[model samples]
Target chain A: MIPLSWYLILAAGLFCIGLFVVLTKKSAIGILIGIELMLNAVNINLAAFWHYYTQLNPSQTPLNGMVFLAIVFIVAAAETAVGLALIISAYRRRNTSVAGEMDLLKG
Target chain B: MTAMQIIFLIVAAVTLGGALMIATSRRMMHTVLWLVLTLMGVAVLFALLQANFFSVVQVLVYIGAIAILILFGVMLTRRSMVDAGESLVHKNWWVVAVVIALLFAAIVISIQPWGAAHTPLVELMEFKEPISDLGEALVDPAAYLIPFEVSSVLLLAVMVAAIYIAVDRKGGKS
Candidate 1:
């Protein structure tokens, strides 16, 4: 049987990977993907806690995690839409989507 | 091992693998394909967690809407959809070192057990009814009405901002 600790560890690993990607990648959409991955890690952690916590105790509703996760997911979607729009606009002006090339603000 | 656990493991593996591919891939189309797989895996994970409504929404909004928009951007901007993605980070190794340190810190914090705040888990008669409850909570006078409306407004603002920028690009306005 997979323990709750195992899920948490996996979630941690995924979160680290997402952070690394976000920090390293130059593409705006790529960073957005990393952000989504990080959000997924958080959602997984929440769901794992909900599952195990409910397993341990038998008096609380099991759907709290689901509800919270649903909200988070929606927020993530909204963030992605806005982020992509920015990316597209940037690409239109620069003719390239490379992150390092976007140095208009650099001194 | 319980079936749920087994299924969860499979979904996690798929999601992680897809995410890695998304990060490392150079081609734009390949990234979009990997994203689709990643989103699908996340949807399955949500289902396994009994968030059926969320699973549907994940598929509908993310896999359907956002992924398509990404591809659309790729096609509309570039002549071909297979440009080699540029590297953004400097050649210094210190960034990797810092990332590793931060990741270790996060893991340590997550694993620490200060005190166990216990709560009971009731056997819900309708695991699915919470979907309706959530819908009601979003609009109810005593619940999350403000947040719900605010989120919608935020989405609308994003939409307007997106259109403005896209059109401004054509008009040569910075």
Candidate 2:
């Protein structure tokens, strides 16, 4: 059987990768993708803790691991929609989608 | 190595490698593709964690739906794929260094408990009843009724918003 540490390590690694992507990627939608990755890493941690929680307290049943992840998923969808809408609107104004090219706010 | 260990390792590799490519890839479309692979690996890992319901939902909602919409958005907005670099700013190596540092700290903190002791795999298999239990809880007044209803409303709102944005205006030069 695989140990729980392995899952935690994986979550941490994925989280860091997502952070890197969000910081490095130039496109608006690409940053959204990075946010999704970070969300997935959070979900992984939640699921892992759910397993551990259940084992430690067998009588109570699992409380809120998957539930938390589900909520995060919904929020991610909402964020993507709003983000893409903003991106589309921005793109309509500026003829390019490159992240670095957007400097309209800079006076 | 055991089958479980091997499976975990493979999923880990895919998730991490796909994430790396997603971050570094120059092409926007290619980045989305890598994200899909990464999501699939994450779903597999969820299954390994014995969260079968979560695993299936991850595949259905994330892979089947959100990924498609994202790709659609990319296709609709971005210009034709150009090999020429289009990035606004060069990546800061310091960010990666910080991430690595944080990762190492997290691993160190997590190792104390995770490495100390472990329950056998059979015990974990028995707790698999959470799937059905979770379903029952979702509708139970004492359980997750509020959050469940809220999520449904949230999803509905997202659907309406996406449709409106996707169809409201078109042919704008960008």
Candidate 3:
């Protein structure tokens, strides 16, 4: 049986890597990729905690964590859809997809 | 170490490595490929956690839907699939690295003190019809009904908005 901390540590590492990508990637799509990674890391944490919680409280319904994770998944899908749409719209206008190059309002 | 522990370690390493590659890979197409690998690894982790439904959903929604969407975005936005002759990272990425290191250390330290952190997972409980339970909870008036309906509405709105935003106007510049 794996310790809960191991999962937590893995989630932390994954989250940090995702953060790094989000902070540094020059492409807007790359940032979206990073956000997906971060969201997956969160899903892992939620699943891990839920697993442990079920162990301690067997009588309670074990749907909460899974429910929350479902919501996160829904949100991730919407985010990707809207984000890519905006990116495509912006790309059509700017003729470039680089995040740093899309500064029209730079004063 | 137990087999489960070993498996977890390998999956974690692969997942994190894929994430690192996504961050550092110079080509956008390669980055999207790495994202698929990383997302698959996460789905594996979900299976390891005994959430079979989520494991399937992770693959279906993440790899199948979101990853393909990202790939399309990459292909559509760039003139060529290969992204070259441009800096992939910010000039001051090292600063961000340092900050992330501190953040990771803080997370580790904070997690270490929890009494339940070291508890090993017990044997799996006999969950009869987990999928049905999840379905019932989603539609039940008392549980997750509102949130589920709200999310459905949100998805619908997002779909409409995305179509509006991405469609080309007849008079607008292409």
Highest lDDT: give the candidate number.
3
Q: Write the per-residue lDDT of candidate 1 for residues B32-63, one digit (tens) a residue.
A: 78988988987887666555676788899888
Which sections of candidate 1 miss by over 4 Å?
A: A51-67, B79-98, B101-126, B169-174
lDDT of 2 by residue, B52-125 (tens): 88889899999887888789878877672243344532557566667666776876576767543354332464
TM-score (0 to 1) for chain A, all models? 0.89, 0.89, 0.95
Which 10-residue window in model 1 chain B sums to the lowest lDDT?
Answer: B114-123
Report the Cα lDDT for residue A99, model 2.
66
| Candidate 2 ranges with C-alpha deviation above 4 Å | A105-107, B80-91, B98-132, B163-174
lDDT of 3 by residue, A1-107 (tens): 89999999999999999999999988888889999989989999999998998889888878988898899999999999999998898888777788877788531
Model 1, DockQ value? 0.40
Model 2 clash pairs are A100-B88
For model 3, the DockQ equals 0.79
Model 3 lDDT, residue A90, Cα: 83
Error of 1 at B94 (Å): 9.0
Cα lDDT tens digits for candidate 3, B28-107? 89999999999999999999988889999999999999999999999898772244476778889999999999999999
Ranking of predictions according to lDDT = 3, 2, 1
lDDT of 1 at A69: 73
True contacts kept of each: 0.34, 0.49, 0.87
